[model samples]
Target chain A: MLDVEGLAKATGAGGKEKIKIQRQITLPWVEAVRISVRNVTIRLGRTMITASGIVLGIAFLSSVWTSGVIQDGLQQARFEQERELVAATTRDQAKPDGGKTEDSAAVPGEEKQAQNSKRIWLVVMSLLVCGVGITNAMLMSVTERFREIGTMKCLGALDSFIVRLFLIEAIALGVLGSVLGTLLGHLAMLGIFALRERSLSVAAKMDWGQMLTYLLLCILIGTVLSLVSAIAPAVRAARMRPAVALQTEI
Target chain B: MAKIECPECGEQIETTGIVTVCPKCGADLREVMEAVGHERDERMKTIVRDDSVTTHEFIVRTRDLKKIYVMGEIEVPALRDVDLDVRRGEYLSIMGPSGSGKSTLFNMIGGLDKPTAGRCFIEEVDMAQLDAFELAWLRCRKIGYIFQTFNLIPVMTAMENITLPMIFAGMSTDEMMDRGRELLDMVGLGDRLDHKPYELSGGQQQRVAVARALANSPAIVLADEPTGNLDLHTGKEIIDLLKELNQASGVTVISATHDLKMIDVSDRVVHIRDGEIERIEHRADIDLEVGGMGEE
Candidate 1:
């Protein structure tokens, strides 16, 4: 047993000087990310529930997008066939056919406009539902972790750290949900095409580039919606006073 | 060769510089030595303060501290113009019944809350003058906190829980692990490193909390009813552990507690009632068995 008291007495005069020389440490961004991931893992059930909302929303959006592109492609091909049919009919009736040709093109244009409005409505509705779900889930998470937030604050975690922690969790959930939704949407398109064509071969006609673009778009929307919904809760958690936060039960 | 009588067993033991345990009864003498060291440190601080003509001897000081919590149309005053000073390396206990505002005062000193109309200085820096970032930095580097409920993250293992503050302090993984292991071992949980809070007993969880609080090598450890959740026997163990740490590391330990066992080891006890300081009792002036002292 070292004479700890004697050592303290011997060094008491110089302790302050030694304290000044101790290096101050700052938390790195990577460590914050690790903590965020750990939090998400611990609350995986809740995180998945929140993400399922995004998943369904993005699935609907991407499905609409993929179906619309395929529909447009098929409609274009049909129009070309119609144009050739009209041209052949005009050639046969060359002395009196311009009026019928205008009617044919106008009918398809009207139908396309109606379908476009329906698709737009579906996309808008999904986004609203996803946003609301995300907001509700994030608010609940903030409320549930009140004491943990307070503990972290007492441990010298900065307000920025709290904000970043929630944001990181949101971002991770967004990415996962978006990827899953994209896959679900593609599978949905495949099912619809197989039912219509009465064969799996119809999916071969679907443009891969167009599908990839729609997936990327859904992922982007999902990420943005997650970020937007989390901001309020994150900011609220950051602004909480530790004393009051520590008193929060459940 | 020098010899000293063991406080617990009353047996004479041969000693060198610092005797950690009594050879006769195997009782810990760290607390007894810590009391001796604390008094000597106080005397040195007084001399240093007198000679320097600058720098306050108190590590923590409060002047006219008041806190009023306004709820809707009702106003609740938690603290009323309380003034206090805590010397470095001292084990001070704040004892009060429920709603006596001891917790409020504890939070004030720990920089976890601000006073409505008073100034608090920790390690000579006025808390009111610090910005949020500066205050956070001060908290990270200078203060450690232990709570009645342990407050360990339920998901993390003991080792992870202990290393959390060091991670926040930006310590390297290797360094954090090394320090975390040392702290866990110090708290007598060397083999339970991988156990989660839920898997551990109440006392074990509190031990982990203690290790977590010491992770950053803070100048002061603020504990609010640290043993409140444990049984009598376990509570005594926790108290002994805290006393040992306070002794071994020379870290200031300020606790808001009602436990007699905790109060017994304190260098001074500040009694509070109705949001006001009733009195402060120095250890020497008080009788431990009776838990009271004569008016000075």
Candidate 2:
């Protein structure tokens, strides 16, 4: 290998005397991700424990989402069936059924609005709990690895590199939890609807495209939430003094 | 507000803000305050990257370095005006009693802490001039550290641990693995590459640590009590390995230890007591009657 100082001097003005290039902390993005993935695998049990918080929150969100789709489909199907039945019997029966149908439809519509608000509140509360959970787990992860953090600092890791490693781990957890929750929530909702309504055809009438969109949106939520929760722990880990590693938990 | 009796001209002075001059004698306190790292000027932000700011020849040098810890109204001074220089490619061991500032001096030379009033230079670059990031940049390429605790990342295999520093040096994955293999083989841990820290014995873990330290082929290696936790035989092995590396590669090795055994391998042995250097002797001249002298 050529001498860096010599190369630096060659690049200097008049090709002599000055030597000016300094090393940069050039940690590649892909390598950071790979390290994080391997770290997650090594601590899979802990990873699962941390991710479970995300799973519980996302499950509530997706279940509520699935319920909304099922209700809309069921209500539309019932409305059409009743209107047709009434039309068939209208020639012989009294016309009072017209007003009754209007009353029934209006009342349920108001009830659904109230229910939606309650579901929104629950979703918010669960998400807040998960944020706390992820933050707590990540903080534990940082503190327990003091010696390891110290070693890396001694080996010349930039603070940004330390922060990057933790964020990657937290995000991976978020993603794993969210994808699983989405599947579980959708399946559970479909099972309940199938048992109660005995109309798989209504489930079929549901808009599949919208469900796909919701799944994507949930994943995005999970990733962002993980990133936010992880920031504090990552910074704390990076700011740890290398000297502390020498005196601690040996 | 703080009040002080000026040492010069016997003048009593009261001040509310930063005071740099005594009223009676016009004695400049600027140098004093700057030594304490209290200057409110551009000097506070300037990071000297060029090596010429400090004198050269010695790989590591310290000038009147001091560190004081303040707790409430009490001040405990750790190191008091330590002046030392270590030559290139020499094996040096610093021996001192507990609370004698051996570790403090070690850390200062390693560029791991700030001094209350002093400066340290590594390869002629002022340690006081670099910020945390730039200090890390220098540490990665210049000095490798071995800890008493054998601080290998617990989750990583030996090979992964050894290659970690290489990752920061911008080496490609292939280059890292090749270098990692060579280093591990050099350390006599080639067969244990896949073993994690927990799986390896104490000596093996320390060997991995040694490999990791040399990952980037640093110019100096700083070992803080390398044999503090090992049994006699294992400790002897580690000491021998360090001596071998010092001889074979010409990398300077500085160890802070009470282990008198370290003296056998060191080219120079420095004895420090009560925050000052007591004496320095070459390997041929050190009086061998003394055992290990300090607790870190």
TM-scores vs. true structure, each candidate: 0.82, 0.79
Q: Mind giving the per-residue lDDT tens digits that candidate 2 earns over A175-211? A: 8888887777778888888888786775786777887
Off by over 4 Å in 1: A1-25, A80-102, B1-56, B288-296
Write candidate 1's Cα lDDT for B1-296 as tens digits. 12456898899764433458988789888777666555434532321121112233466777789999899999999999998878777789999998999999999998888899987867656678667877787777778899999999877899998888888788889988888887786666878999999999998899898888877777788999998899997888788767766666567899999988876789889998888999988887665564432322
Residue-by-residue lDDT tens digits, candidate 1, A196-239? 96876545666668767887988999888887788898888888
Q: Which 10 consecutive residues of model 2 chain B have the lowest summed lDDT?
A: B40-49
How far in Å is the alpha carbon of A136 misplaced in model 2? 2.1
Instruction: For each candidate in the order shown, give its overall lDDT on alpha carbons.
Output: 0.79, 0.75
> Which stretches of candidate 2 lie above 4 Å from their native place?
A1-21, A91-97, A192-207, A245-250, B1-56, B70-75, B287-296
Best-fitting candidate, measured by TM-score?
1
Instruction: TM-score chain B for all models.
Output: 0.79, 0.77
Model 1, CA-based lDDT: 0.79
lDDT of 1 at B127: 76
Residue A46 CA error for candidate 1 (Å)? 2.3
Native RMSD of candidate 1 (Å): 8.5
